[model samples]
Target chain A: GDSVTQTEGLVTLTEGLPVMLNCTYQTIYSNPFLFWYVQHLNESPRLLLKSFTDNKRTEHQGFHATLHKSSSSFHLQKSSAQLSDSALYYCAPSMNYGSSGNKLIFGIGTLLSVKP
Target chain B: GGIITQTPKFLIGQEGQKLTLKCQQNFNHDTMYWYRQDSGKGLRLIYYSITENDLQKGDLSEGYDASREKKSSFSLTVTSAQKNEMAVFLCASSRTGGAREQYFGPGTRLTVL
Candidate 1:
């Protein structure tokens, strides 16, 4: 089965510090589409970034992620964490199931807490 | 440019009762999905529909029923609410699912007493 993993359940950091949230995936498919979604307090989850091409860095809203096929990883990173960066992050991979439809399998979300 | 609307932002039901959640998307997307979100558990897919009248069971579909009566609307029903159950149900849609970004609704918070 295809699955996404985010080892850290929670990551707390000070404002202006570097940020890195680990994400790894397991899939039998040759080409996988990976995505990152962020959910702020009392808000719906929204797309942060996504990529299918190997080793290509996809970035949005000051966050970036590189999908590495050889390592099966799509880690989210930011040079400097901000107070607004605190949110729940989910790593998802789009999976195709023939005619049924494509689905995004989400990882156990990592909660990033940034403090002043 | 479109929005996904989920009815009844909060719901309270008794144990053993049946509850239904409604979702509507103005995006006119062909694929819709229902997912359950629990604390520290991530989003678990309950059901998804490729198109109108086309339904597919997901990893966590045992206790739920889904309907895709129209392309822009999808509904989910909990067969039996369990005591002390608390979670958020999210409805999302994609242009066609594969290699597409999903737009999510504001979710319905369910509480079973």
Candidate 2:
């Protein structure tokens, strides 16, 4: 079984401040795909970024994450926070099961709130 | 480019009532999934279908039933709605049963009284 963990439940930041949301995962498979999904207030969740290559930084919008196979972590980071960046972020891991289908195990999610 | 559509943006049901949620995808994807999202609990996989006529129970499949009527459609039924239950049901689809990213629908908000 595979699982994802987000250490922070809620993160409050001021506008223009740096943002970091920790994410780690557990999977038996050596190769796993990690993803960050974002959901705004009253909106459906959408893929922010994803990575399969270890130690490679994947960036989308203003966020970036590097998959670290050694640490089993894919922490989301941004240099500057925007008011619009306030949303719910989910850390999910997808493992290949051949014909069984690749299922995504989502973390409890971290809510990021940016204030002026 | 395609979209996943979930019917009935909102649903209100009484306790112990059986409720059904519908999902349709135009991506022509081979796999469809149903997930339950609760506040602070994230999204939990309820059921998934690799292909038409195929169904797989997920971690939160208990008290729920699923049907893959066709390659483009999948439906989930709640065996018995629980009192005070409030959650969102999301439908997603992927190109194949591999490591591809999933596309999600707008979701159906459910509330049980």
Q: lDDT of model 2 at residue B6? A: 95
lDDT of candidate 1 over B1-113, digit per residue (tens): 99999988999999999999999999989999999998888899999999999999999999999999999899999999999999999999997744778999999999999
Task: Give the alpha-carbon lDDT of every model.
Answer: 0.92, 0.92
- Compute the DockQ of candidate 2: 0.80
Total clashing pairs in model 2: 0
Give DockQ per model, in order. 0.84, 0.80
Model 2, B1-113: lDDT tens digits are 99999998999999999999999999999989999999988888999999999998889999999999999999999999999999999999987744578999999999999
Most accurate candidate by DockQ = 1
The ten-residue window of minimal lDDT in model 2 chain B covers B94-103
lDDT (Cα, 0-100) at B35 in candidate 2: 94
Please list the residue runs of candidate 2 whose C-alpha ends up more than 4 Å from where it truly belongs after superposition. Answer: B97-99
lDDT by residue (A53-112, candidate 2, tens digit) is 999999999899999999999999999999999999998888778878878888789999
DockQ of 1: 0.84
